[model samples]
Target chain A: MDTLNYLLQGFGVAFTPLNLALAFAGAFIGTIVGLLPGLGPINGVAILMPIAFAMGLPPESALILLAAVYMGCEYGGRISSILINVPGDAGAIMTAIDGYPMARKGLAGVALSISAWSSFVGGVVATIGLVLFAPLLANWALAFGPAEYFALMVFAIACLGGMVSDRPVKTLLAVLIGLSLACVGVDSNSGVYRFTFNDVHLADGVQFIVVVIGFFSISEILLMLEESSIGQSIIKTTGRKLFNRQEMKETNPSTLASSIGGFFIGVLPGAGATISSAIAYMVTKRVYDKDGSFGKGDIRGVSAPEAANNASATGSFVPMLCLGVPGSGTTTVMMGALALYNITPGPMLFQNQPEIVWGLIASLFVGNVVLLVLNIPLVGFFAKMLTVPNATLVPGIAAASAVGVYSVHATTFDLVLSVAFGVLGYLLRKLQFPMSSLILGFALGDMIEQNLRRALSLSNGEVGILWHSPVSLTLWIGAVAMLVGPPLLRRLRRGRAALAVG
Target chain B: MRAERVFGLVWLAVSAAMAWVALDLKAPISYEPVGPRAVPLLYAGLMAACALTLVLRPHAVAFHWPHGKVVHHIVVSAGLLLGYAFAFEWLGFPLATALLALLLGRVFGGSWRTCASGGVAMGIVLYLFFDRLLDVVLPLGLLQPLFGG
Candidate 1:
């Protein structure tokens, strides 16, 4: 009842004409930026953050605008994934696995609407979870020390090889390569330049945007070139323009479960929508793939990841608001935005600045509703991107790729690096390697290595420290079971069948 | 499978070089308890193992290089893209973008008129939206005088 009262007061602040207008504007721009090739929520927020500050809006309104953009981008990312095989950002990668196939089958509208709906549900649920559990979840998240984090990240990486592909070894190799690439820059702890090759730009290591734009956009451009010799529309736009009752019924359970699971995962510091969505897709595949329909336009496959991605985006805000620990990469930038206002978010924040805290939360609820309303109407327009002829679309993609890659650092070197990664991605793709594991490895490599090192250092270089805690121990045992269980189960089933025949 | 073997050998050489570099990478002093070297060495070691498995097994999946004109298309496209990238800072977003769009549009089977008009519109509209509206700080370069940059 008290929570409801606080929320009502929050609504009082969020419903102000200025805050509401800011919310709509942020959602509008954010969705546009998010659908652009290679740009995502981080870019959306980061780009608009300065404008919000320069306009000198009060901290609460500025925060509301930025948060709306953050949520809007999460919805926007699925548009690119459904229309093109390329993901808008790391979090949307799993959406593309099934979404693109659905688009190819002339269900682009169904994929877009379903994704938008799932994203809204996830964001709303996560915001509710925030209201109820932010403080408690933030405290619990502290229990994840370096060892536990290392174990968890390893388990997440292991999840990829075990399920994402028929060739586990090849998937594992892709991950290993991504991890190695992550090691190229100067080491954060000791400042040792590993594989810099004396290039000043390499001293900072490869940027994630550079790697992503290269690996996805470049490869996509080439693939389109090869397959588009006949220059057909990217996908047909005919068929059901929206998901029907049965389609929604089929996807509801996966979307709901993944939303909840995704929120919890997002509450963990340093884990973001990327890992949450990836895990959600894999888990949903395991639980619901009775027809082996995952990665083949399965509506469940699309909803699961989209829900998790948006839920995780909302969940990330909890740690930032409650504990002042930035939960995800996007929130880290948001933390900087807050710093511009001379605000330090901590336990005292809710008490000290109730309007700021509660208003942001209230705006999340508002922002999500706006996103759903905005996305549903825009579904047809976004889906029509499929009908964009390659003549126009191909060049458009290239220009967008260049803009996206260059805008990150405004450096030509990153642009060149993107092309290089594109070539490598093309080759690996031809060899049947799943790029998702590679991306997951690159994203998580720094986290895993840093945690491992920190945990080891805490124990004075004792390897056993990794599994010493009950949390880490349980996680280790689970990871081992995950790795060893599938093949063993297959053999057991085969043996039982043989025995029955005998 | 034969292509996989060759690719495996390439990966093996790459990992070997990675390990060699990782071995030489050193911290000035022992500031970090585990140091930076160990983690990189671990990556190198694991990569080496995967590369070896590739060399030994080289999955029986056959790999074929793209054929003839498709190969031609790929090479030209890649070359054009790299050229656009290298020339990006010099040519500026608008000019470089126009050239890239025009050429890539042609490669994708657009008529000269369609490619030219489409390319120009894309270059100009994106620049206005991203640069003027969004304040993204793109270089005007040759368009400096025209745009009063």
Candidate 2:
């Protein structure tokens, strides 16, 4: 009943005229940004965030706009995948596996409408899950001491290393670089300067926006410049209508199941939409492909990944709101946005700032509906974005990123710093290192170090204090498992395959 | 050699240098059990170890750098943007942003006429949107004498 009351109050906050307009605008702009080649949810928010912040809106309004953009991108990512066989973002890669094939089969209209519906279901279900599960998780996290937090952060990074790619060592090095970057300001506890190198800008450490925009937005511009020409022709959606009732009934159950599964995967600290959507698609394929029609334009294949990615995008927020640990790369950028307003999201956010927390949740509910209504009728319009010239867009993108970075501190030094990180990001991308883990590491660096230091101080400098509690001990075990489990499982799978062959 | 190997070598060198520099930071009045320097040193050491792994194992992946005009485009745009950043306050919004847009449009293959028009539009539009509507502080610089920013 109290949850209901709070949600109602949150609706009161979300339904305000200004918040409503921004949500609509955010969804519209976010979809355009997402469907553009090489741009994604992170860039959408990172580029727009400075403008939103400069508007001097309250923290709740700012979060509302950012979350709306995040959800809209998830919805829009499927368009490019379906039309051109090129994914708009990492999460939509699996969507293209079946989406483009469906488009080729003259069912492009059905695919777009049904996928939009699936995305809507996934987002709505995940928001409901957030309302229910986030508080319970926050309550559980309240028992965590410093040692447990430190252990949990390591487990988060290790899980990211384990799940992200085959190269854990590279991920570790990237994360360590981020951690080192995080150490470049004045020490919070001892008030001692560590890596400032006599620069006044170093006093506050590298700004979170500078690093985020530097990495995702600025580097993306450079990458887009090299890959400028879009050679693939888009499948036209001429005079095609929305999916009918029969198609919806056919996909209803699988979409719901994928939504639930994707939401849970997203709740895990390190796993994000890419993993969730891939797992959901594969699971649906294994179960439903008894007739061998899974990947060659199966509607379920398109719906499954779309639903999962959207649900996973929402589910990734639970950890950020509950524990201040970002659940995915996009949420990592959102965390930086929250930091811009001096608002650190965690348990206290729920208690002291219910308007911010519940208001954000409520606005997502509203935004999902906005995305659905806008996507179906506007699918043709958005597909046209595929043909938009890179020449005009790149300069505009660069200007937005420049103004975004420059507007914050109004300084050229930060602009140069962003360009430096952009170059670093470009190299990292070319080298095939995971950029998210580095940013994740940078995000969690201070917390882990401070927690370890605090726990040690409480224990009179005894290292034994790290695992003194059951929570910390379990986290340590989990960290080890995350690091070790993937390779061992891969080996077992290979063995099974060999045995089957024999 | 693979890009990762060469990059890893440089990273290891950087981390070692950072670790050396980290040793110099000391707190005369320390409250925490771990001194301020310990965290950076620990991170730097871990980074060094990881870099060492990359240098040793050296996995191979195919890489193709864009040739000729593409390389020129990338290098010139980078240099132009950096110049824009440094000259931002002095050259101001519309003029500086217009120049950046003009050069970027050209590098990306726009004709001179379109580039100039687009560049001017970008400069003026963004200035109006960010400065006038949002009230975010933006410098006018040379335009300051006329427009009075």
Candidate 3:
């Protein structure tokens, strides 16, 4: 009842004229940004953050805008994944398997409609989960100490290690690289410059946004050059009817199952929408075996991953709000944005800033509704965006990015830095290195360092203190399990397949 | 085989340089026994390890040099950026952007005519929005006279 009253207050704030207007505009723009190739929620949010800050909206309203971008992006990313064979982000990668096939089968309309519908349902379900569960989770996080936070950081890094490909060690190296780069500016505890190397810019530490833009966006531009074409090969898309009763019935079960699966996966540290969606697609395929049209344009295949991805996106917030730990790359960016706004997310957030928490949560429901109405009716318009000549779209994006970066700081130095990072981002991407880990590492580096220093300072530099608390110890165990378990599980599955063949 | 060793050796050298930089910090602000040098030094060690692995891995990882035309595209892109940087400080936002955009647009498959017209259009949009509407002080350079220096 108390929570409900607080939530009603949240609804009141969210529905205010200006906030509601921001929510609608944000969702609308966010969907378009998400639909654009190579940009996902993280980039979409990061790119638009300067504009929001420029507007000088209060922290809560700014958060509402940014959060809506995330929600809208989760909806928008599926379009490219389904119509083109390109996943905007890893989470959407699974959506591509069945989605592209569906598009080719001329059911692009059916696939897109199902994707939008399932995402809306998953998002709404997750919002309810947030309302009911986040407060309880926040209460649990209140018990954490500095030691626990240090453990959590380690767990976060380990979870990151688990998420990458064959090179777990490389991922570790990347994390170390990020942490080392993060250590560049003057140490907060110690005024000593660690790796500034006599540059004035080094004294202030590397900006997380600069590093992220360089590693992901710029790197992507370079890699795009290697590909034969800059845009999708235009196809005559088919399927005009949006949805019928039979189609809805076919998807509902998979939607429910995947939503549940995605929600749980999302709550886990580091694993995110991409993983959830992939797992859901696989599970649905394994269980249903519905004529095995999964990879060949089956509507259920599209529904499963889309539902899972959106649900996981919502679930990812569970840790960010409740535990002050971001569960994915986009959330890490959100956390960084919050840090810029001087708002720390944790257990006390609910008590200390109920309106920010609940209003933001309420806006999510409203954002999804706006996304559904805008996405379904206007999808054809967005799909036409794919037909934009590569020559025009690429340069336009580059110019917009350059303008956005410059607008943040009128400094030519920052543009130079953005360009430099963009080149480096291009190269790192070529090697199939996970840039998410790098961004995550860069974002979390300061937290790890600050917390470790604080905990050590409290314990008079005794390293054993990090393992003292039960919560900290358990979290460390979980992190280790996550890091080591995935590969082992894969190997076991492969072995089982061999045995079965024999 | 030797190429892998050379690549690893260069990384090792870079790691050594980074380690030296890490060692050269002034002093700690608050007393922690290890100071700020510990993490960087740790990175130095890991970088060295990775560098060693890269050099020692004998199984050939195929390295393909891109075609000359592709290389040209990359060089052109880099050159455009370099020009943008130099031009931005001297010519300011409008002219510098126009030149850079024209060059970049051409390199990325735009025609000279397209580049020129697109550059001007892009410049006006940026000028009005960034400088006029948003109160951004873009470099006026010679244009400063017209806009009140």
| Top lDDT hit | 2
Report the lDDT tens digits of candidate 3 across residue range A131-231: 88899988888888888998998898788788765656556766766776788888877788667677786678876666665566555555555555555
Per-residue CA lDDT of candidate 1, range B11-111, in tens? 88987888888888778888557888888788877877877787888777866777899889888999889988987788788888889888988888888
**Candidate 2 — which residues are off by over 4 angstroms?**
A498-502
Best by DockQ: 2
Interface RMSD of 2: 1.3
Residue A491 in candidate 3 has what lDDT? 94
Worst 10 residues of 2 chain A by lDDT: A223-232
Which clashing pairs does model 2 show? none
Residue A49's lDDT within candidate 3 is 68
Model 3 CAPRI rating: acceptable
True contacts kept of each: 0.75, 0.72, 0.34
Docking class of 1: medium
DockQ for each candidate?
0.59, 0.75, 0.44
